[model samples]
Target: MKTLFSLFIALLFSMVAMAKDTDTRYYEMRIYYCHPGKLPDLLTRFRNHTTKIFERHGMTNVGYWVPVDNKDNALYYVLSYPSKEARDASWKAFGSDPEWKTVATESEKNGKIVAKVVSVFMNLTDFSPAVKAQAKNPERVFELRTYTAAPDKLNDLLSRFRNHTFKLFKKHGMTNVAYWTTIEKDGAQPKLVYILAHKSEEAGKASFEAFRKDMKWVKARDESEKNGKLTEKVESMYMTPTDFSTIK
Candidate 1:
């Protein structure tokens, strides 16, 4: 029993390390909730100054978007760093930069621009494509999806997506942008988050409806869940790229 327990410990750490892979780039997703009627000011600041400061601090700006409904007055964006340590360092520098401080103060002169902020750090999955900026496209809509894995079933969930779901999504007219798993500090539970692009919100919904009915997907999902369901919950949001977004 002692030997068996030791092997189990080793395997658990191995899996965690494989998922984190701190040596590689680490990504952060941030949502800024602006004060009512203050969102436009926040966007202007980011467009004119914040993005440049981020680049100066060695952060890679991935994409920025706002929800179609705008019900939450939130701005969502993703940033990447060379490594976990680099991410921390860059954020520290960004917070203290004189220009950033000035810009923040200026943007909020009328009133506090942001009411709240949420951030989640993540590691890119092996199956994720390299995220890159695209030429501006006014017609594209992006969907962000989050899936929570069932207890001790994270591997099974990842395997299913790796082996099957990714392909089916593209086949159904979805463009796989990137896939990530939240770092333990940010994700108390095992979870997967990914982005997909479609021609429009209508197109995105239609793609998923078709994807669900595909026999190949139905078979793969059933086979992967022989032990039990792989996910506990799923959340999806449709967003349009901001005019200044790099991924637009």
Candidate 2:
């Protein structure tokens, strides 16, 4: 009996240690540009000054996007980190880099490139199965999805999502790793898009199975169908994180 109890205790300790090591923090940076036309300029600055600088110091760039809907006026991007400490330290160093300073100054020389920008932070919810289930196996199989809503349908679309679809997602194990919306800074149209970190392409594909069966999802679908369509339509794209990119 004594030996069996000791073995059980040791197993429990091993499980606890493993759980602690799997804690990952994903950062979703939603950068809404004020001027859509200045996007080219902003991208150049991002590549040279911001993203490149972070990569030099070690930050992972996970995904990036610009709205395909004509109603959207801003751009969006995402990054992830092993922990918030890594994020803060790497950004601190990158922010203080002399080369980055030079790039920033030069980037702005042409004009006031960005009129305004807003950022929000979010954590993967505890109930997220992708985040929780993937803890046991750290395999690279996740993809990010972004949905851009039409200008007029933005509020209604988000309402249906928050009130209806989100619960369905949880039920189906469509683990939402991070989520947020964009705020108007300059020329940006009001819009919302969210990113989900799937474990594998197959897992991501299979999520629709549960989603399709969930009664709540069906109800939500019916309600949207009744609303004569809340979104202007949706644009979706699949992406994988660049190895060693700063947005990760």
Scored by lDDT, the top model is 1
Q: Candidate 1, clashing residue pairs?
A: none
Local error of candidate 2 at residue 113 (angstroms):
2.1
lDDT of 1 by residue, 38-122 (tens): 8889899989999999999999999999998899999999999988889889989999999999998887778898999999888
Alpha-carbon TM-score of each model against the true structure: 0.88, 0.52
lDDT of each: 0.91, 0.60
Worst 10 contiguous positions by lDDT, candidate 1? 17-26
Model 1 misplacement above 4 A: 1-23
Which tens-of-lDDT digit does each residue in 1-248 have in candidate 2?
A: 99999999999999998688553574547566646467667766666567766667876564555543424345566666666688788879987999988887887786776766766554443333332212323343334444556556666776787777777776676656555454345755545555554566577668867788878788887887674666664545444433323333
Number of clashes in model 2?
14
TM-score of 1: 0.88
